[model samples]
Each structure stands twice: as C-alpha cells, then as structure tokens.
Target: MTIWLHSEVGHNQDAKKEVKAFNSEDVFTTPKPERLLERILILATNPGDLVLDSFLGSGTTAAVAHKMGRRWIGIELGEHCHTHCIPRLRKVIDGEDPGGITKAVGWKGGGGFRYYRLGPSLIVKDEWGNPIINPEFNAAMLAEAMCKLEGFRYAPSEDIYWIHGKSTETDFIYVTTQFMSKQMLARLSDEVGSERSLLICCSAFRCDPSQFPNLTIKKIPKAVLQKCEWGHDDYSLEVKNLPAAPPTLEQEEPDDRPANSRRKSGKGKPRQASLFDMGGDQ
Candidate 1:
C-alpha cells in the first residue's frame, strides 16, 4: 500500500493558497488542492486523456488537468465561471500560474479551451396556452433544436438551404419559421430530387402529404412537443437552494512512521470517460 502525505498530495490549506494567489479578493470557499488532483490524474490517466468535472467549483480540476497535459472540460452554473475559472485557466494557459504542481510537472503551459453557453428552452406556451417555439431562438438555433428532437445530427449544409441536419447520408432535415405554401413545397421537392429524402419542419404548410414522397413535411412546436418536455427550465440536480453545510474534518491519530516512507506504483492505462458520457449521466 502507498501513503500520501500532505507534503506530497497537499491539503485544503494548500488549495486556499493556490486560489488566493490567483484571486486574492474572492477566494473559493471549498477548493481541492492541485497536488491532490495531480496524484488522482497521474494514477487514473495519461497525457492527452480527457478529464471532466461536472460541478467545477473553482476550476481546480481543469487547471491541474491542463498543467499535467490532459484535455479537460469543466461545467459550472454559478457566476464564478466568469470570475474565477476563466482568469485562473488563462494564467495556466499563458504559463503565469506557478503554484500547485506546476513546478513538479514542469508545466510551461500551451493549450486552449472552448466555452459554450446553453441557450434558453426551445418550446414555450403562447398567450392562448398553445405550445409555440420560443421567440428567443433565432433561425439557426431553432434549426439545431429541431434536428435534436428528430434524432438527426445538427450540421447545417454550407451550400444548401434545405439541409439543416441529417439522419443518414440520404436523409436530411430543414427548419424554417415561415409558412410553407404548396408552391414552395413543390420547389423544395424538385430541388431535393428522388434519391435523397428531406424532413421539412416549418410553422405551417399548405401541401398534400402524398404529393412529395421524398419529402416528409412536419410543423414546428407541434411536431416536437410530444418528443420532449416543454416549458420547464430548471435542470439543476440540487435538491434545495439552501447553502451547503460546512464540511466536518475527521481527526486522525498522529503518524509514528517516517514521512519519507511511501510506495510508488508504475503508470497504468485505464479507460478514460468522455465529457459526453459524463454529461449524459447528469
């Protein structure tokens, strides 16, 4: 068995020092030490492995993962995502952060990360209590949302207006908030050709369903309402809005063995979890 001393893996106090070094004015209340994360990563992963932290409090996991040369994704709901996480990660990328396992891992830091914000819910109720597509969503956003509902991959074609997404090489989806007339449908049907199939989603359409065998026409809001939950937005897993109680630390008996007495194991390759897999669980 191997032993990890505070000197090797660090403790909460060390985490405080690291956060304070980056943001002295507003330190995270409960942060994990970077050395602790380093040890976890060293055991569980290798360079280029993806690391994911769902409840990324102060972005310690991401920062440490980046320093250790692992790809990382961090999800945060609170405002600290803008304040603390972004700045701390910028320092890590620019090789400005010298604290934590930066020295031990020799992390000179050269990497980048993408940030994406979730848009508002797609379906909302109108004044008459009928389900309608949320006005907050623009054309592109509506197209993407419809693609997901219909089990199609959201990839808008650069050359074709009718191709918003695809289910197969021959099957495609088109989304528009405009009212589609029979003439418009005929034009689209002609353009789509006989070999390829297209799923047309619109606000309203005046066309016979049997006329276009290659095109499957569907109306927005109505077509998607039965597929997914509507008008509910709070997706957090927290049971309550109350502040979490302070953690109680367990007292341990004093160690009689020397601090240098510890065991190290050789690196092993374990299957790493993807960010998508982690997100799906949540």
Candidate 2:
C-alpha cells in the first residue's frame, strides 16, 4: 500500500482554501474526503467488501475505497458529481494522482466509485422565510446538521459530544440542534446521566430551571447558525448553489470484488471499518 500524507502532497490545499467555507455557504460541502471516508470506513464495512456513501461529495469515499481494496457505491447531488466527483475519482482510480502528496503519504492507488444523488430537501418554505421541516426532524437530518456545525462526520454509533462544564466534575454538550425542551431534559437526566454522572446535553435551546441539581442545558452551537447556508425562503441556511450531483453509476461493473475475494479466500480476515472512525465515535 502506498501511503502519502495529504500535507506532503498539498491536497489539504482544498481544505485550507476555505477554512471559512462554512462561514456563509456554497452550494454543497466537499467533505474532507479523507476525513469522512476515514469515518465511514470505520462504521460501515470491511475491506474487499462493498461500501456505500449516500453523499459522494468530491468522491472521497470512492477514492479511499479504491485505495483500500473495497468496492464502493456512492450517491451524490450536484454538478460536481460529474465535474468534480467523477474527475477526482478517475484520477485516483487510474493512479494519475496530480496531488502528488496523497500518493507519497502511503496512498496505495487502486479502485473506483459509482456516484449517486437524491432530490432536494423535502420541506417547503414560505414567503416569511421560515423553514418548513418535514413532518419531523428525523435522526439522519439531526445527525447531519450536528456534523455540519461540529466539523465532523455524522456517526450513528457515536453519540454525545461533551462541550464543557463549569467545573472538573460538571459538563454540558449540544447534542442535537432540535430545541431541547424541559420535558426532554427530565427524560434524558433519567437515562443519559445519573446522580454521579458529570455530563449534561441539550439541543438548540434550554428553557428549564437551572437549579436542577446535577443537570445543565445550553443552546445549540452558535457556529451552527453562523456556518449554516440558507436557501430560498428558508430561515436556517440551505445547502444552495451546490453542484446537484445525484448519485449515478460511473463505472459499469464490479471487477475488483472477485480479485480481492479470491486473494483473501482463506485468511478469513474479519471485516474492519476505517481507522479514522474510532476518533470521532469515541
């Protein structure tokens, strides 16, 4: 396996280019391909097995999957799906990395991605500029929104990000942006924490008695508001102007599968997720 550090290849240039990219909002976000791929590979599949990324972004998952000897299916929405996503994946697949550094950083070249995309967000906004969230805020949306703010990939297995506490034994966290009401707190205090537990979590806002003994709640992250991208008639920023690259099959068949399968036919290497995921989940 060829390992190339992105810093050496200068690929993080893309990441550095827009340290403030989230400040306003472009159309779509190009997930730190390496970072997100690292997390996805961790939570999802084992090498040589199939991997799926609903949000292809700049084709990071595809590139990583190929390099790690895994077959991947990706879905994306935006123009980059064709221009940015396809081209990037192709570069890695053909071992024609111009980034130069990823290759040197141990990036073993190989593999490819099949892109995909879904339709626009389900909710509809009105004249006054208020977002009309679909019937309810589902777990996926909440997870994504939380990740967008925290600058991390949304992971199902990893719950609870401890923000800060007033003291060594006390702490709080902004779990989900969905406003955390008092009733919810009572329930969580019962389950998420105990009389001795030092952690507390809340959503967008906390409207409850502050003297709840061992529990504390705070508003959702302020950066979430600053970093959000609003859309037409929507209050909370929308991921507008993004290259709507819906997921589509770029490659024709899955040839790599047979090869990796045959090579490790007897080793019985238990499937493993990406190494990066552990950092985020824990």
Candidate 3:
C-alpha cells in the first residue's frame, strides 16, 4: 500500500479576502489563512482535542478549531480582542459567518464560550516587606486561596470557626487575623485531641511551641511574605505612560552633587523600558 502526501493548502490572498469579508474592511495587516490552520488541525489533532492560541491575532486559529469540532481557548491582550475577535466568534457561533473554512468543514455552528477578565492579584507586599491578602478578596476567596497555598481541601466547618479547611480527618488548618494567646492555643490543642493535629495561621501567636506538640503555629505576613506580590491588585495588560527625562545635560545635573557621586548613588540616565507587556493568568 502507498499513501501520497499533499501540502500547501492555503494562499495568503485567501486569508486577506476572508478577513475583508468578515470585518467589512481589511483591518488586520497580516491575518492568518483559515485553510492553513485547517490543514494543520487535520494533521495534528482529532475532533474534540483541545487547542490553545496565546496570541489570537484575528481569531483564525479559534475559528478553525471551532469549525473542526475541537475545543479551543484564545487569549489576546489588545483592544482588538473585544472589537474584532469576539464579534467574529459570535457570528461563527450563530452560523451566520459562511466564509473561511466553514463550508469545507460543513460547519453550521452551535457552540458557546464564556468570556472572563482576570481579577486582582491574590497577594501583595507592603512597604514593611509583609505579605498581605488583596482587599478585593472576600472571606470565601481568602479561604479558598489559603487552602490552595497550604495544600488543603476548602471545607469550612459550620460548627467550628477555627476549622477553615483540612488535609485529612485528623489534620486541619485554621486561618485568622487575630493573635492567638497561650490560653487560646491550649484550648484549641485540647479540642484537637491526641490523634489529631491542628495548624493555626494567624497574625501573631503568644504560645510556646513545646507546650503544644500537636499544634503547629505559623505567623501570617511572615509565613506568606515571599509567596507572591503582596498588594498589587490590577493584572490587566495595558500600556503605561512613563515620567519624562530632563532635556539637557545642565537639567540632568540640577543638584550640586558631583557626577561621580551621582553615578555611585545609582542615579544614572533613564533606561529604555520594555515594549512587550504581559499579565493575568495563563
């Protein structure tokens, strides 16, 4: 038996034409050919396989993947994501778009996808180098995040405010902002019993470790200090304006400090910033 291999399925002009048809104007300067993506999809994946496009320029990959009966995720940081890609995908879902590889794949679409924006950062650092949870997080969100960080299941107990979560029936975790005194620690240790162990995470603790063998005490802020960025809330990928530099050499040397002293003090000329920006969860 013999098999003949065929390649070069799509032309660049076809891609341009498809974009013009869908967008009513050729907005994308370099749109990808749907037929090219279709060929790649056919070669590399089976139906229902997952496809991910990190830079979904014109939504060609996602559209092709959707038409091919594959689940797909596409991420784009630019405003065109909302202006172009989303509308095009919505049209594809409603079976209104007849361009691209739709006819070739026999696509009369009936699929849906939900859109979501990245929320605030979970943790951030304060000026004092202490880790603080984001104010945007509610009690439930905080508990969930703590459970994930500590490798415990999020199962808050209704009867016990101290029991925020657990790793096992005999091993439990508690999260709080209040300081735990030695008397309070003793009471919790007694409640946990000999067979069980308890881990308490709080702002501060006045108990001695030797007194409670079964109770593990951890101080917050210090414990999670190096875990993540403490106070940064926004994770959006947007360009930022920077401070302008002094125009002339005299303006640069406004102060009476010597040039060598300025250099030693780490006050050099302004450095060029990075062009590419990225954020949010991947």
Best by lDDT: 1
Q: How well is each residue in 1-282 modelled by candidate 3, as lDDT tens digits?
A: 133232355677778777776676547778878888998899889997768788998889998998998877798988878777888888888898899889988999777776756556766667886557667877777766666556566789999888887764556778877789988999988887776667777779885766887777777666566544444787543324432332343555454543222221112332222111111121
- Stretches of candidate 2 exceeding 4 Å from the true structure: 1-88, 91-93, 96-127, 131-137, 151-153, 157-183, 194-206, 212-223, 229-282
- Give candidate 2's error at residue 82 in angstroms: 4.4
Which residue pairs of candidate 3 clash? 123-229, 123-230, 124-229, 124-230, 124-231, 125-230, 125-231
Clashing pairs in 1: none
> How far out, in Å, is residue 29 in model 3?
3.0
Candidate 2 matches the true fold with a TM-score of 0.32
Off by over 4 Å in 3: 1-8, 20-22, 128-130, 135-282
Q: How close is candidate 3 to the true structure, as a TM-score?
A: 0.53
lDDT of 1 at 86: 88
Model 1 misplacement above 4 A = 1-4, 124-132, 144-173, 178-181, 191-199, 204-210, 213-218, 221-282
Is candidate 1 or 3 superior in lDDT?
A: 1
Arranged by lDDT with the best first, the candidates are 1, 3, 2
Instruction: For residue 53, give model 1's deviation from the true position in Å.
Output: 1.0
Q: Which has the higher TM-score value, candidate number 2 or candidate number 3? A: 3
